[model samples]
Target chain A: MVKVVFTDHAGSEQSVEVATGVSIMEAAVSNGISGIDADCGGSCSCATCHVYVDKAWLGKLDAMNPDEDAMLGLSTDRQDNSRLSCQIRLRDELDGIAVTTPEFQF
Target chain B: MSDSIVNEEIDRRPESKWSMVGKDPYSMPLEKIDLAHPGIWQENEFLPFLKRLREEAPVHYCAESATGPYWSVTKYKDIMEVDTSPHIYSSEPTIGIVDAYEQFTIPSFISMDPPKHDEQRRVVQGVVAPTNLKALEGLIRQRAQTILDGLPIGEEFDWVERVSIELTTQMLATLFDFPFEDRHKLTYWSDVATAIPGGGIIDNNEQRWAAMEDCLATFTRLWNERINAEPGNDLISMLAHGEATKNMPPMEYLGNILLLIVGGNDTTRNSITGGVLALNQFPEEYDKLRSDHSLIPNMVSEIIRWQTPLAYMRRTAKVDTVLNGQQIKKGEKVIMWYASGNQDDEVIENPERMIVDRPNARQHLSFGFGLHRCMGNRLAEMQLRIVWEEIMQRFERIEVVGEPERIYSSFVKGYAKMNVVLHPKKAA
Candidate 1:
């Protein structure tokens, strides 16, 4: 199992043990973590699952794909560390990855 | 009579030749196929046509049809491109392919661009907020239990009328605080609101107006009553007292009312019916459900994706836009076929079959996306989740006994009649 921490807009953090190969967005949803609507079901569309990866762990995952990047660019709150959680698969190397969800996903 | 008028309109229109291709969809080139014709949907021949469009021509154009020329975005990625970029692809004027009759188009927030759309949407958004949804859960579960418990076992009955329509209409009545005895009128108005002339629900435009006038009159009375009362939680009261919506014009008020009614009624209702049909179609999935009830919520999303209650939403090009290398001219109708998008193999693996536990189930475009996404989506999902939970505890199977009589229109992809019989589990 890989552990990923999600800090919601309210500053509450939830660390969930997700099975390897599951996307972080799926982890947040199946764990019932709030603030990740994941409305488009983690497709590279619908930026509802946008999250800011912790600076230290950002380079651990593969580079963001163009589709995910375009969707993130649509968000007014995007940051350098911004990533769509749906695009990041949970792996053994990314056990301690952390990301913060934006206040609004619309 | 309505058929003759359609024939007359077709004969008079100089553009009718292009539309003739739609008459024989099977022989027409895949790229030229028009799924907008109500006949294609009514005859239940739309599935293969849509499949072909998704494969051969992801962004095909139909230059002629009952609703005129429009672009069909069939692939998941292409549909998302149009749906997300509201600025280029405007929902203004209307969302359906058919133009609203002259001086009759209602301007609801769903059809408005930002500033106005955001402001008006904020007014009633509270009705489906998380806090409100939490409060409504108990009531929805209780209602679902009552509705399910009332169904007769071992007897074929129309599930569309008894289960799907009844539960959704009940929810709508509570939302508006509408008269319970007259709650069926909500369903009636919803059907009439989206009905196509000679499409089996209404005969002509005149009858359509007559039905809508009845809807307007009925809701106007409720509006008047609620406008003066203390602010309440019901949808009518929300609009009546909302700062942005308190003084809407007659047509705008009617438009918003129809938006809420149809938005609330159809999606969830069809999913309820579709869920049973899908389970029956794939019994292993039903076995999966029976073995693990925890999959209910995910399965709910899967059902909505599989059914895609609303097939397509039309948007007009505010500016010329090139989507998937296809030039969409300004003012051209660009339709995002959610039904096709939901089945796009590129996005969803093995897109053909129902897998209740599909991991990315909620990724489907059934509730739409961006600012105009279905406002009552959470409410819709909550209702479905509760009903199915109650169903799992009660019955071994809700067998689909006969063919589902589908609705006539291409817009609302749903059932008109679905005969079902409940197979009750013997009391432990």
Candidate 2:
């Protein structure tokens, strides 16, 4: 299992563990984390699953695909480290990854 | 195009002779069912026909209709597949059931494919983005209060006119930085843009074209005024200075403007009216709401699902594709029935009931899915949320005193007239 920490807009953090193969979006959703809406059910279509990767762990995650980049562009809250959690799969190398959810999902 | 040319084109087009009105769903043959007809929709008799289609033929085809042959995708999952795979199911030329005539068609991002679609959508989407809505919330609440406070208690009034139309029109005007006094023209043009010819809003295509010309002229003046000014937060200013849109031709500019105006206007207006009607129909749910005001946010989503305003969006098949075991050929029209999918019992439990606190209400198909999903979704939600919050504070109940009249078009599902009486809260 890989560990993931989700920090909400209010600075509240919730930690959860899930199998390594599942996406970070699934881990957050299955663990009942408050911030991630994942409205498109992890298709990377809706930008609702957006999260800002912690700067320390940003390089550890896989690169953003064209679809993810396009979807994130529509968001007014997009930032330098912004990523759609659905596009990131949990892996042992990224076991202690931390990300923060935006206040609102566009 | 000149008025004489427009008249000639209108005269050449044939009128729709087929209608599904007064037809019994159970008695009709399976292949004979056509959901495109505005007859059953305006009468509020579309549910059974939609149910029949979802059960028997999830991806059914209609060979002969006013809009020509098209496939009806009623299941939620099937609709999702079609929506997400834009490469297979393209949104081009037009998204309406009826094919666009060369002279009448106005090119907009909604009907364009990717690269171009992405570029154009990115330019104006920020206007209604969540961050922008935060700024708009205060203004929206103040307007809602003014409109609601003006209502007469214990007296019958047309809620559709006084509240729904007025509130949404004001909101639209604010978005465009339009003159508040002439805001009613936005509502009229929106109605005209989506109006089905011979559907009471307009007698024929000529009238529809004439109204559109007037809309174009008005918006053109707004564009010219804003183009050289300092960049502002309003939508018109955004488009006037937008890199991808600034150099667009006159027809394209008018098309995009009409798209935003109609997109912002009718959908929410009907949902506003629909919420009152839905709560009246489901008094127990209304009781649930009165007891816990926290349910207001969730209730807003349920109301959107129940209304399913702007019932279906049309996509043309780009290639020979098989969806849900049904074959859709190249260049054929595929209509995703959001109204039916929202009520698909397989996905939503007790699909017909208006539960105030229904879980996963935001997952409904009302705003659609994939690339062309409604850009103004958050704005619409905020407007509904604020309206409900202010409403609970002031009125005990918004009672629907009479039968609500529905709109004529199958595309824009909403109320045309609804008599309502406000009941103020008894002092605690």
Candidate 3:
């Protein structure tokens, strides 16, 4: 299981362990994470599944792609660490990843 | 109507990154886009991609010129979180997908924050509100029935053009209190503004740009004329005196008016076409629906879920944040794949299959979520529902004589020209 931390739109943080093969959006929704809304099932279409990658862990994760970049342009509160949770896949390297949720998304 | 391109000719398997025509974001392969032909999603690489994302990376990453590098969020529950929150992610920069921020101006309320967005939306909200729509239901039904009367049984026609565009455009004209004769212009302007996906159907960047600018100037002229004229019941009049809009300069208002044409056009057109196609695709569901019209609402939601008119919308990051285990920097863009979200296995059971009675169908992110949900959603639904109802009563079946064509752009998923053969109950 990968330990993931999420911060809600209200700036609340919750950490949980997600399975390695599962998407972060699934982990959050199944474990009751309040902020990550992956409205589109990882199609690189909708920007609802938004989250901020912890500053320290940015390098560990895979780089962002063009489709994600285009969709991310639609969000309400985008940040430096802001990433769509659906885009990031779970793995051992990201096992202890800590992320923050923005205060708002659209 | 069947789109023209034959699916059998393409690779039957899901398009792998390596197998894809172009691996990198910078070099866009136009060949991969079957502009003249529609792709069969049921058997295409797109559906499997959604399934894989659901089981694998609910939130996936994508790199492109618009946001450089960004994440794509998939899965139902996660999308809800984004939809519900508006303060964090934003759409103030642009609305059309695929295009960079420089290509388009700041969108209207469709991409704005609460206070400012709600202020502008209020003008039309009263006019297009569900309650107001209910008041216009009889009129809409009458008009719809009249249009249905014109369909030729077993003869081919472009449903996308005849039914979807004309009906919705007429309705939009009503909301704008526009002159009935000028309704076609609204559709034209919308098509131009929405050409952000590879610069529209013609693929001519310069021509589309010049045309759109000209159309925009005309809209500005008209908005000014209407606003300065009598206080009519249309959106233009409302905006002229509206609390949120009265103070704004003419350019912003012009931008918003142009925004309206796009906001109204692409979405409603795709919905109707999508609905009819969905019903045709599932003959059993169509039979069930035709036999029992009560399933129209659920079917409408399912159509919205299935079609997802505005394919993908974007949002920018405000600060440093982490998604899943990925590191994200400040001011980065994140794209949400609503199409994939709708098919998330974790959220909707057998999401790939369109179950008419799917309880969570409303959970789809087609109209978007949170602060920027499509303001014209009610109007869209009303029009679609009415269209399907009329179809159910008027036609025997909507046959697919030609292979349907898909939109060329990555942002919007729809048919530009779908040639369909309609078999009606009787000749009009």
Candidate 4:
């Protein structure tokens, strides 16, 4: 299992032990964590799963694919650390990685 | 499967494609792809043809079709591009490839562009808002339990009518605060609103028009009643009191009514039926589900993804645009095949199989995207979750006794009749 923390826009934090191979979005949804609607599932389509990875662990994740990059580009609150949670699969090295969800995901 | 609800004669025309069912769809040239014909879907043979289009020509154009020429956006990324880019690919003119029966075009916000669309949609958005959804959850679960408990055990019955349509129509009735006793009328009006002329319940344009008129008259009566009543939580009351919706013209009112009914009905209804059929088809998956009931919510998303209830949503090109290297001219109809996109191998790990616990199961394009994304989406998901939860508690297995009778229209990928025999779980 991979341990991950999700911080919603309201600043509430949820730490979940997600099964390995599951994306961070899956962990949030299974735990019923709010702030990430992930409307399009994890197809890297709907940016509802947008999240800002904690700067400390940003370098550990894979580079954003063009599709995820383009979708995040459409987000109004996108930041340099912005990454769609659906695109971020949980891994051992990222055991304590934290990500913050935007206030609203259109 | 028995004969479809729609008459077979309607598909016997010389130009109809029903006769080509046995032919290998993959062998056909990409240019020959026409996803509009309902016959192909009624026969349950649309998958391979769409797969071919999605693989060989993701943005292929069909110059000749029952609904006239249009572009098919088959891949997941391209579909996202078109569905999200509402300005470049207009939803106006109509979301269905074929224009609304020329004589009966009621303009709804789903087919309108922004500003106007956003203003009108806000009126009823509260009905499915998070707070409203929280309040509705208990009511939905109770109704689901009642509906599931009432079904006969070990008897073959049409799941579509008995379970799917019944629950959704009941939800629609609750949303509208419509008369409980007259809830069946909601189903009838919704069917008539979507059925093609000379197909199924509607046999002619006159019959279709009369049904619309009746729908208008009935809703107008409700509108007048709510217009004077104290503000309530129902959709009618919301519209009656909303600044942007209060003075909508007769046709626009009818348009919004159809939008809510079809939106609230088909997606959940079909997913309910499809989930059962899918579980039966992949028995191992059924075992996986039976072994772990915790997967119910995830299974609901998987079911919606697999069903892709509304096969496609048509958009008109607002201006010349280059899509996936294909040139699209202004005023051209572009069909975004959500069903095809959901199964695109490039995105979905195993696009063909049914896996209840797919990690990113919610990533399907079934509800569409952009400003016109389904407003009742969360509500739809909640209802499915409740129904399946209630089903699992009562029955060990829902045995498919006969082939399912699919809805005749390619537009609404659903079943009209699905025979199932319930096997209740023995008490411990």
Candidate 5:
């Protein structure tokens, strides 16, 4: 199992443990974490599951696919570290990765 | 104006069109069921036909209809697949079931493929983005209170006109920074944009073209005025200064303006009306809502699902592809029936009923999935949330007093007139 931490816009933090292969979105959703809508259910279509990965772990994640890049491009709050959580599958190396959720999902 | 006159008009029309209107969904051969007829939708008889399609043939083809030959995709998963895969199912030419006429065509991002779609959409999406909504919320709530407080308690009024149309039109005016007095023109142009010819709103294509011309002229004046001024926060100013859209041709500017106007207008207007009618239809759900006002946000999503305001979005097959074992030829029209997909029992439990706290209610397809998903979705949700919140504080119930009148098009599944009476909240 790997540990994932989610910090909401209000600065509340939630940590959850889940087996590898599940996406960070599924992890946050299953743990009843607020701020992650995941409206498209991980299709990378809806940008609702957006997150800002903690700067340290940003290099460890998979490269953003063109679809994810295009989707994030439409977000007004998008930052350099922004990523759609559904695109990031949990892996052994991603253990203890922390991210923050925006106040509202567009 | 009356049912008999409308029926006589349909009867007098050529039999070749609207042949499927009065036919039974089950008794008729499966191949004979045509879902595009505006008659079934306006009459609220489209559900049975959609159910039959989902049960028997999820990706059935209609060989004949008023529009032409087209494929109906009725399942939830299949819709997700087609919506996400824009390369296979292109949105170009036009998204409407009817083919586009060269003179009337307006170039908006909703019907365009990516690169260009991505560029133009980026320029204006921020106007309704969630951050901007936070600033607009207090104003929206203020407006809702004004509209609701003025309502006549215990007396009949058209909810569509009094509450739904009025609030949404006012909101659109604020979004565009449009002239407050002429805001009614925004609502009229939006209706005409999606109206079907020979339907109640318009008599023929020429009338629609004239209305479009007037809309274009009015907006052109707004654009010229805003383009030379300091950039403001409104949509017109944003478009006037937007890098991707600033140099666009007159028709494209009008197209994008009409897109925002209609997108911002008709959709939420109907949902506002639909929520009142749906709550009355399911009294138990209303009781649950009255007891716990905390459910407003979740209920907003459930309302959108139950309403599914815009019925379906048309996508043309970019290449010869097989979807759910049915081979769709290149350039054929494929209609994604979101109205059917929302009720597909496979994804939603008790798909027919309106459960206020229904789990994952936001997952519904009212805002079609993928690249072309409704950009103003967050704004729509915010408007509904504020309206309902203010409503609960003032009214015990907004009762649907009489039968609701529906719009004439199948594409826009919404109400035209719904008589309602408001019951004031009793003191604690």
Candidate 6:
């Protein structure tokens, strides 16, 4: 299991142990972490799962694609580190990664 | 006697190059029922055949000249994968199943990527905040009951055509702030927009253009009205007043309203009729529902799962990515089947069977997930639950007397017409 911390737009913290294979959105939802609604079930269409990954690990993981960039822009209060949690898979290197939720999912 | 006419395969074009069920696995004759004709599509096809396709390839792929034979992503897990991965997959190319013309751009923020998508959705969301959604609830419920109240006292009517459509239209009218008298136009326009080939729900392009033009004109009127008036809480009002983001242009507002129509209209209508159908097929389950009303919420989720209303939401790949060991190139279409994913055995037990209290009800992909999840989901459930409650109190028995039909649409999947004979309840 990978240990990850999730921070919301308000900066609330949710520390949980995520399985290696699950996506960041899955980990947050199954654990009952608030903020990420994920209405489309992780489809790129719905921006409900918008998150801002802690910049510490931004360099280690893949960069946001055009779709991801576009979706983040759709989110409320998106930061430069904004990323769709569903796009970030949990790998060993991403174990300490943290993500902050957006102000709104609509 | 209730009759059901279902056909998994609607109209087949001989030149179709894709085959999803057979030999090449990637190519199969396009086999899908038009959902507009609820009577025949549900009765003769849809369900039973969806089961067969599941058995063959949990992840079936097909093409119908729209997206040039894209992946179906049929299995529950696979569909979820497609839905979950926004960066790797997208909604750009073929927003849904129907392949529109190159120049034809629908202001479907749902299908757009972020920056722009976010601002537009934000504008709408602002209008539908919890407070707004709550206020609309009582009114919507009342509207639903009023429509039900008007149904034939003791006759089995076509629930989809009568109850569901009327209920949804009234709710939409509130959202659009259109006068209640013009409610039918909303239904008519929405129906024409989602009308598929199998059900003949739509007329030719001229007819479609006329209806769309009318809708556009009405929206223009609304926008101008809002622009003139100060911003209020309503969606159109909020959008008119809200500052457009750098990406969301002011011109796209009218088109965005149309997107809201399709997003809200077809999805709820299908879910409503699908809920009734699920109850009809699972009599024992329905009985359970009749006895314990609390399960209405779960039942709503199950119906959305069973119906999987909006069929395949198309996403284009923004970059080359590997899924299930397959190499997907950039700009390729990845059609996610939320309906198929809701039934994945891995995620839900006996995915085919409708479990009223299925503990993990959120697993279904009906509302979608990720950044682009459905905005009207909460209201949808509220409407469905109230509809069922009224049915339980007012109906003794409702059975299909004539064959049901389905929408020919590859996108919105639902019953176009379902005839039923309702045994009205006598005074307690």
**Best candidate (score: TM-score):** 5
Looking at model 2 chain B, report the run of 10 residues with the lowest lDDT sum.
B5-14
Error of 1 at B95 (Å): 0.5
- lDDT per residue as tens, model 2, B61-128: 99977657899999998988888888899888788777755222578989998989989999999999
State how far residue B213 of model 5 sits from its true place (Å).
0.9
Docking class of 2: medium
**Overall lDDT per candidate, in order of appearance:** 0.82, 0.88, 0.67, 0.83, 0.89, 0.68
What is the TM-score (0 to 1) of chain A in model 5? 0.98
iRMS, all models: 5.8, 1.2, 8.9, 6.0, 0.9, 4.5
How do the residues B1-428 of candidate 4 rate in per-residue lDDT, one tens digit apiece? 11232233334232466334566887777687677777778889888988888878999899976667889999998998898787798878788866645322478888888768878887887787555777989999999888898999988888999999999999999999998899998898888777767557676556766777888899999999999999899999999999999999988999998889888988789999999999999999999999999999899989999999999998999999999999999999999999899999899988888899987787788988766777787788889888988888889999998789887777889998999999999898
Per-residue alpha-carbon lDDT of candidate 3 for residues B1-428, written as tens digits (9 for 90 to 100): 11221122222122422233223322434223221111223223455455555566666665532223456666766666655545566665655433332234534666666567766766655666554677778988888888888877677888888888889888888888777898898887777665532333434445455666676677666678976888776788778778778777754775778777777788888888887777778888887886788888778878888888765677765667666565656666666778777777766677666667777465677887544667677678788888888887777788866667666445657777677887766654
lDDT of 4 at B422: 96
Interface RMSD of 4: 6.0
Looking at model 2, residue B97 earns an lDDT score of 77
Error of 6 at B101 (Å): 2.1
| Model 1 agreement with the true structure over A1-106: per-residue lDDT tens digits | 9999989878988899988999998998999888887877766666778888999997788998766765665454678998888899988999989899887664
Error of 5 at B414 (Å): 0.3
Tens digit of per-residue lDDT, candidate 1, span B332-378: 99999999999888889987788989986878889888667777877
Give Cα distance to truth, residue B55, candidate 3, Å. 2.9
Locate the minimum summed-lDDT window of 10 residues in model 5 chain B.
Answer: B4-13
Give all TM-scores, in the order shown. 0.83, 0.96, 0.70, 0.84, 0.96, 0.75
Q: What is the lDDT of residue B95 in candidate 3?
A: 51
DockQ for all candidate structures vs. native: 0.19, 0.70, 0.05, 0.15, 0.83, 0.26
Better of 3 and 6 by DockQ: 6
Candidate 3 lDDT at B394 equals: 73
> What does candidate 2's lDDT look like per residue over A1-106, in tens digits?
8999999999999899899999999998888987788878888778899999999999887789887887887788899999999999988999989999999988
| Chain A TM-score values, per prediction | 0.96, 0.97, 0.90, 0.96, 0.98, 0.89
Best-fitting candidate, scored by DockQ: 5
Error of 1 at A69 (Å): 16
lDDT (Cα) of model 4: 0.83
lDDT of 3 at B155: 77
